[model samples]
Target: MRRSGQNRFPEVDALRGCAVVMMLLYHMLFDLVFFGNLKMNLFSPFWRGYVLSGASLFVGLAGLSLTLSFSRERKHRNVVPFSKYLKRGLLLLFYGMVITLVTYLALPESYVRFGVLHCIGTSVILAYPFIPRPWLSLLGGLGSIVAGYFLSLKIFPFSFLLFLGLKPPRFSTLDYFPLFPWFGVVLLGIFAGNFLYPGGERGFTLPNIPAFPFRGLAFLGRHSLTIYLFHQPVILGLLFLLGLIRFPL
Candidate 1:
């Protein structure tokens, strides 16, 4: 969360920071595999579950924050505006496109065509109409989960529906999160946000932590997008340099 208004939620920021930390740990293991320093089944059931958990947390947080935004607007004004959500979603989509280009150039074989960024961006746009109706969003989210589970079993002729969880039998990507089950997680977050934090304000009190670790996590959460874009390059570069010391590329 970027501060769009005066109101701030420390709990949300902390939770997001926790997600970021979890993502970094997972990516570090992935980088180790890429660097030939470790050999583990990346696509193993355990790893897949790990990835799903992290992604769910991240996407769910996005939905929660969106609800908070709407609530904040409604508090200040009589209505909530879709323009702000649309603007942010489009910006995220553009960034996702840039990532697609970079990844295709860097690692064409396993490029990200419809990664988490794309899913989140598209989900935000699609979720706008349902923001006002928390119960409906909840039901839709559950339905998506059931639908996506079955959809994943089937294969499409083309990769165009990759964003929608449809793809060819052999299609694969380094990062892929279709708007099926994942979007359902976001919708659940919206429901939780509305239920827990009505009107974008805390429903219960949280004790103050006068500690630096918590503050550092909050900072990381606030600037997650910047970190996500650069962390891979940084990790890869360091690993490559380390590998050169003992083995030839």
Candidate 2:
């Protein structure tokens, strides 16, 4: 659409933006429940699917983009390219730590352990080589969900595997993606991306955009990384400063 090298897929970016938007909404809702202002039991097994779904969408897109990043028609690698991915991953790890620090400072008893960003970030680095393979990625991604589901129903030293989205247990982290299942989703995306866009001048067909809104979604998509890292903090700050927090401290 915008020349080969500068070939930006509006659809993918839009999807990432959408994921970020959903993430904010989900996290915000959780905050409400955590503060006890909301009536819903956000963590009930019946409703937990909603949280996992948002995570699935986000990771699926990450897989999809892995393919886009290597389009042959495209030039100009990312600013730091692979390193940037690594850096983003580490940044998330650090952010997770910082969250623990803040929570420990505030609500020490229920601090966040392994949130989505940490899972996503860890996957980014681990997902590199796998991006080149499709079948493997699919198996791994779907495997995560299956594993987590089954693992959650049991209890044993082996049960902790599910929290990693592999084996399963009753124990829950503040936000857990577990390397097993989430990585599988990412792998599935990689597989899709590879099958769709296998590099070179003539790779991957772009579908026709039929009347979908574009510019705004594209901007959100482009800035999704920044949005993910900051949206909640900004919103939480706003709530705190505005005295809208009703957690009944």
Please give the RMSD to the true structure for each candidate, in Å: 2.8, 4.3
User: How far off is residue 39 in model 2, in Å?
Assistant: 2.4
Error of 1 at 50 (Å): 1.7
Q: Pick the candidate with the highest lDDT.
A: 1
How many Å off is the CA of 40 in candidate 1? Answer: 2.2
Q: What overall lDDT, based on C-alpha atoms, would model 2 receive against the true structure?
A: 0.67
Model 2 per-residue lDDT at 213: 60
Q: For each candidate, give its TM-score against the true structure.
A: 0.91, 0.75
- Per-residue lDDT for 149-228 in model 1, tens only? 99899988888778888878788688888888889988989988888888777777677666567777777788888888
lDDT at 68, model 2: 68
Which 10-residue window in model 2 sums to the lowest lDDT? 72-81
Q: Using TM-score as the measure, which candidate wins?
A: 1
Give the TM-score comparing model 1 with the true structure, all chains together: 0.91
